[model samples]
Target: MTEPTRVLIVGGGYVGMYAALRLQRELRRHEARITLVDADSYMTYQPFLPEAAAGNVEPRHVVVSLRRVLDRCRILNGWVVGVDPVARTVDLRPHGGPGRVLEYDILILAPGSVSRTLPIPGLAECGIGFKNLEEAIHLRNHVLGQLDLADSTTDDATRARALTFVFVGAGFAGVEALAELEDMAHDACAYYPTIEPGQMRWILVEATDRILPEVGPEMGRWTLEQLRGRGVDVRIRTRLLSAVGGRVVLDDGTEYDTDTLVWTAGVRPHPLVRATGLPLDAAGRLKATAELTVEGARDVFTAGDCAAVPDLTRPGETCAPNAQNAVRQARTLADNVVATLRGGELRPYRHAYAGSVAGLGLHQGVAQIYGHKLHGMPAWFMHRTYHLSRVPTLNKKVRILIDWTLALLFRREIVSLGQLSDPRKEFERAARADREGRAEEPVLR
Candidate 1:
């Protein structure tokens, strides 16, 4: 009897989950024992996160439960702390605890990226990021809560600060999030008697010369026009020098005191890659060939944001870190793994850049598909079409569609469950009361 081949995959993002799914489909029964380790139990559909924050989609729908999806693969809800490729072992820290080591025959490194934050003062304390489901829900509640605070406050400065929203980074994540949330906030104004559309400000600061660089220069210009037309203060070539003391100081010497600061500048590879002791590219990504195999490491594969896979289509450059590339790479990576296991020829990954789409609030957007430009309703429709087709799983697609359908027939829900984020606050208060020699007040329902 032969020992079962142990295959371990790190991370539960698009790359890891999709690769595992394909692996399960391709491999023969009992041929491989697959174990997937991730810090999160759910795979976040990152593109829908903006809509989740805007109440256009349910928060739960944005994340697919890995346990349900990857039932065939043994799932370990933990983070990969280190990898020993020479010894074929991995160290895992389950939710920031002490480590556990596991041995494997094949290792797939797809730990994915984290929020690429800068050392901007007060940002760590005051600023919020829009990368995951928790951040999305927190942002939604915080935005709605700001409206509530602004409506009740009599002071002009406090109301202004609360109403002022600043989003730094003009990439897809930052731009889309700002656009959707701004639209939602504007629609929410009707519910607040004291608030007006003009009173609320949506400021977008980009360090680059333009926004939506993925959409090309022409469409990027059009996007700027549309945003400015809708009263969005889009500032380009502006660096956020310091956000200390809740005061945002720009490189252009402009200053603003705002309560909300969303940092979506970009993302960097996960820190675990450093501990892996693998050869990395100049950008710190694991250097990978077109077939998605790590250089100088046999039986080790990497893809998605963590691997710098060569772009055969672009010659000198590597594939960009986007969902389109990630999905395609995952499929190719899985196939390559199967090929290596079964002694088949591996195929190189090469794909052309499909056109780009951007939604600027409701019923308005800009899309450039295969040299054709679209705007307004057509572009908004395209945005929905492209995303719905890409969002993975028929069940989630149906749920998202239902959410949108319901939105057309009903008003958007503005309720906030802020307490969910800090469930221990009530317990802390109760403990304080007990310390003060007062009987617990029946634990307020």
Candidate 2:
């Protein structure tokens, strides 16, 4: 009676979720028992973040529950603190519990990346991120909340600060977020009697001269011109020096007071990957071969933003850290894993560059696909269609389609649910008031 192999996966992102799905379908019951661990139980489709933040798609639709989809595999909702590959054990701390050690026969390392933020002053205190569903929902609420505040405020300075939205990056995350938000804010102006679209200040400070560099420089320039045409202050070759106390200081000797500061600079490998004590490349990514096996550690496989897997198409380079590659890498990594378990030959992972697509608000986008350039509605349609197809699961696809259909039938949702973040505030205040009222009452003799 031989025991089944235990396979442990370390993330729930694109690579983690897709790899687990493929593995469960391909591997037999007696061959392997798979377990996946992640800080979040649901996988966020990051490509739709801008739309989610803009109210085009509901936040819940952008995320897929790991447990529901991967029913064949065991799912643990927690973080992987560290890994001991030599001993085939991992330090995992489940949510609301102390922690425990999990042993495994094979490890699939796909912890993914964290937002790469700089040591800019006051960024930690004030800046909001756009990496997950929570942040996306919060950004949507906060952006609409600002409109509410600005409309009600009597003072000019307060209204100005509330209306001034500054984003400190021109990458895909920053650009898409800013564009979609600006569009939402513009439409929301109809509801706010005192607030006008022209009064709202939207600024994008990019450290580089070009925006959307992945889509090529010409398209980047076109996107830049389009943004500028829409009254968005797109600053090129600029960097954020400080943002202390809602006062943003640019490196080019310019400063402004703003209540909204969004940081979408970039992302680095997850810190836990380093804690694994495995071999890493100069970029801090785990070094993996073309077969997606971690170099010098055959039992350990790696992919997504955490692993620097060789790019067979480029010969000397590695696969780019994007959804196009991440999704593909997961399938290849899973097939190779099954092959290794069954004593079959492993196949190398290879993918050609597929260009990029970015939506700039509604009915506007830029796309570069296999040497073809598209802009305006055509590109926007492609962006939506491509992501809709790749967003995972028929359930989510239908939900998103329905949302789009509803959007076409009616006006976009502009209401802010900012209170959702602090739902207990009212309860706590009422409880305190009740206690204080009782304290003030006179006691009977």
Candidate 3:
């Protein structure tokens, strides 16, 4: 009897998750031994993150458990420290154990990107990036906590600083997050009679001339107008100079004291790619063919944000690192992998640009689909409907639909569970010694 071919998949993002699921279903039992390793146990549905932060959808539902979805494949919770394609072995460091080596016949490298940050002063300490669930949840708690501080303080300076929120970057993540959170903050103000919505300042700073470059200029300008109409200060052609000690300084010479600063500028390919010794493009992403296989490496495949897959439709560009492309590529990648294992021909991945849809706030959105632009409530419905189909499993879809249904029936949830940020605070306080002194040693010298 022949030994089963071993396949190892790195990362648990959209590409990794969908690929594993498809491979497990497509490949016959014992045809291939599939193993997936990821630092995170669940795959985060990133498009819903802004809604999660705004309390429009429950945060827990935004993630799909890898173990639950990919039940047939062996799941390993760890980080791949290095990948040596020459040796056909990967080094993974488990949560608490020492590093271990795992050999594989084929490797799927989809270890997504990380937040691309610059060395702006105080950015490391102050700026928060919107990438994962933890950051989204933390931003939600921090934003709501700012409201609490403002309402409790009588100091004008302190109140002003607490209410002023600054978001740097005008991409989809930045725009959607700012709009959703701003809407939530405005709604939350009803609870605090002393805090008016007009008192809060929301500023968006983008170095580029226009926001939402993925969407065309017309839609981008429309989004800008919509945001400005909502009382948000949209400053384009401006770069962040420094954010030292909560003081935000823009290249345009505008400086202000703000407690909240969010950085959603962009992302770079995961650093693990460099250590793999694979052929990388100028942007540091894996150089992959239109078939989604790593160039010059027969047994290795690549996809998602980490791979620069040649855009067959455009003829000169690579697919954008977006969820749409990631999910779509997973299907073709999985099929191609199975075909390669069976000695069959591979198919080239080709998909046209489907345009973009963005949520401005609850019950508000902008979509430019197939060159037709849409806005207001109709676009909002379209935004929700489009993502609804793409958010993975039926269980997640049901839960998301229920959340939307309930929001329509009742008011959107505005309660800020800030204690989630410091869940052990009360316990730590209780464990501390009494003010008088430490308790006398129990009958000990």
Every candidate's lDDT: 0.89, 0.92, 0.92
- Model 2 misplaced stretches (Cα beyond 4 Å): 438-445
TM-score, ranked from best to worst? 2, 3, 1
Candidate 1, poorest ten consecutive residues by summed lDDT? 436-445
- Model 3 has an lDDT value of 0.92
Per lDDT, what order, best first?
2, 3, 1
Task: Name every residue pair that clashes in candidate 1.
Answer: none
TM-scores for all candidates: the values are 0.96, 0.97, 0.97
Model 3, residue 362: displacement in angstroms? Answer: 1.3
lDDT of 2 by residue, 199-309 (tens): 999999999888999899999999999999999999999999999999999999988899899999989999998898899999999999999999989899999999998
Query: Per-residue CA lDDT of candidate 1, range 221-307, in tens?
Result: 989998898899999999898888789888988888888899999999988898998999988999998999899987899999999
Residue-level error in angstroms, candidate 2, position 403: 0.7
Residue 379 shift from truth in candidate 3, angstroms: 1.2
RMSD of 1: 2.3
Question: Which ten residues in a row are the worst by lDDT in model 2?
Answer: 436-445
Candidate 1 stretches greater than 4 Å from native: 96-98, 437-445
Clashing pairs in 3: none
